[model samples]
Target: MPGAPFLRGDRVDLRTVTPEDYDFLLEHGNDPAIRHGAPAPTPVTREDLANFVEDDDESVQFLACHGETPVGFVFLFDVDPWRDHAELGCWIAPNEQGEGYATEAAALCLDHAFGDRGLHKVVARVFEHNDASMAVLDKLGFQQEGRLREQDYVRGQHHDTLLFGLLAEEFEV
Candidate 1:
């Protein structure tokens, strides 16, 4: 079972990731649909996933849970404390995508980022074809700052990656 939440919201709670959650992470990492928007879509092994969970020193990762069941994950990576910014990344399970879990979970992380961490900005990247992620970023008040044309090759074709940013002052609860 997952541990208690580190950040709580109305509908979801963000909990620190644990070894028990490795299977959940592995399942999502290998799902093509889930991996579609990822910059690196290569197949991942259990050992590889374990390494990510263990060796991450520059990122803060959390599991989004609804009543103890993990529904998704949200994280701040590429954190540059000197610059007061970090990159946000998240994914919800296929069956759980339409709900508000992603938004709420991300909001909780943003709260931590801009509030507790005293960050100046948070950025996110999404593939052009990822409408869901775009919507989520939009809801979180991330402005589309720029785009990298044909930056990622997925499923045989190249797709542009949209860069979005949210200033600390621009974020809303």
Candidate 2:
């Protein structure tokens, strides 16, 4: 279990992700607009995404909601307890891309990371072409850490990834 209870913000409420949410996760991740923002553009099969959702091994998967509607999913991976570092990823519905929901949800995640989880750092990777994602990480006080060159090959072309990380000591929260 996560060290704290579910977190919520003005625009979004975050709860533990469940198998029931698998269909939404799979469908949203495959949305054309959403796929374009991600570095990997492969077709996300329902079974594949379900498998991914099934592996919430660290109790880190979160389903973000807008009131009663499911917007999308977010989670942390690559947890190193000794190092207190993990990577976070999130996706909001194409229609819900703006209005600061992403930032709100991300802020809640960071609180869970630093406040409850006792983590020292949380990282995120955004494609160079995704300005909105970069802004959300920036608002959450994450700093650019490094660049992974040609880290992702999608549709016969390679794309770069920008890594951003937030340290507990560095966050204003």
Candidate 3:
């Protein structure tokens, strides 16, 4: 707990997602609140997640930790080396929300995306109704770029998908 973190932050560390962490993903990742931004419709099986962790070559993913405890996840996906861009995605456990973990992890991912990965830009698509996620992006200096009208239907309601983008030059830290 006193040593260096995998990717150190003020309040959290970002480390590679391991096979053992899939169990944690199964439990926290499927919580209804956490699923609000997830692309998949249903909870995934361990096998499905295993394949995801193994087959995913375009994304840079990390399991968020606080002193060795897994609290959430962050990812930069849909990476296009030629295009110099990627899509950002992240989530904190329901119990861990509001502690600033998501923000720090996201910022770290952006650092890796821009500093380490040398990407020109990063983008995110969030649900219109999810103000919390939108606020997180806003705090990270992402600009609202566009919106897709009623692009998602969940809980018997249609919601627009808001697109946010941040250029490498726009990154603050």
Candidate 4:
């Protein structure tokens, strides 16, 4: 069973990641549609997932759940308290994509990031081909701050990576 939510939204609640979620995460992380956008598209193992869940002190990771069902994952990683900023990342299950879940979940995390954590800014990196994620970031008021040319080699081709940023004062909802 999932634990109590650390952050709640109208349709989604961001809860602490637990050991029980490994299988769900493993399946999604290894999915071709999902892995292709990842920085390293290498297969993830149980050990890798475990390490990610347990060893990342600089991240605030959560399972995005609807009611009692997990639908996606969201996190604020590479948190730099000294700099008052962090990188936001999220992924929805393929079956649950295009339903606004990613946007809702990410908004919830941004609330925590800027409100609770008192962050000045939050940034995200999206692959050039990830139109969905780019749309999500756009809806969340993230501006395209920069772009790296051919930054990631996905599948058999190189893709540009877009950098987006949102300031705490500029966030709404």
- lDDT tens digits, residues 5-109, model 1? 899899899998888898898788667888897876588887776666678777888899998899998999988899999999999988888988999999999
Which one is best on lDDT?
Answer: 4
Ranking by lDDT: 4, 1, 3, 2
TM-score of each model, in listed order? 0.95, 0.89, 0.94, 0.96
Q: Compared to the true structure, candidate 2 yields what TM-score?
A: 0.89
Worst 10 residues of 3 by lDDT: 1-10
The regions of model 3 sitting more than 4 angstroms off are 1-5
Clash totals, every prediction = 0, 0, 0, 0
lDDT of each: 0.89, 0.79, 0.87, 0.91
Ranking by TM-score: 4, 1, 3, 2
Highest TM-score model number: 4
Query: Candidate 4 — what's its lDDT?
Result: 0.91
Q: Give every collision pair in model 3.
A: none
Model 4, which residues run further than 4 Å from truth? none
Clashes of 3: 0
- Over 1-173, each residue of candidate 2 has an lDDT whose tens digit, in order, gives 12122787787888766666767777888887887778646788867666666754553777888776778777777777788888898889888777777887778887887898899999899888889999989888889989999888776777889999899998875
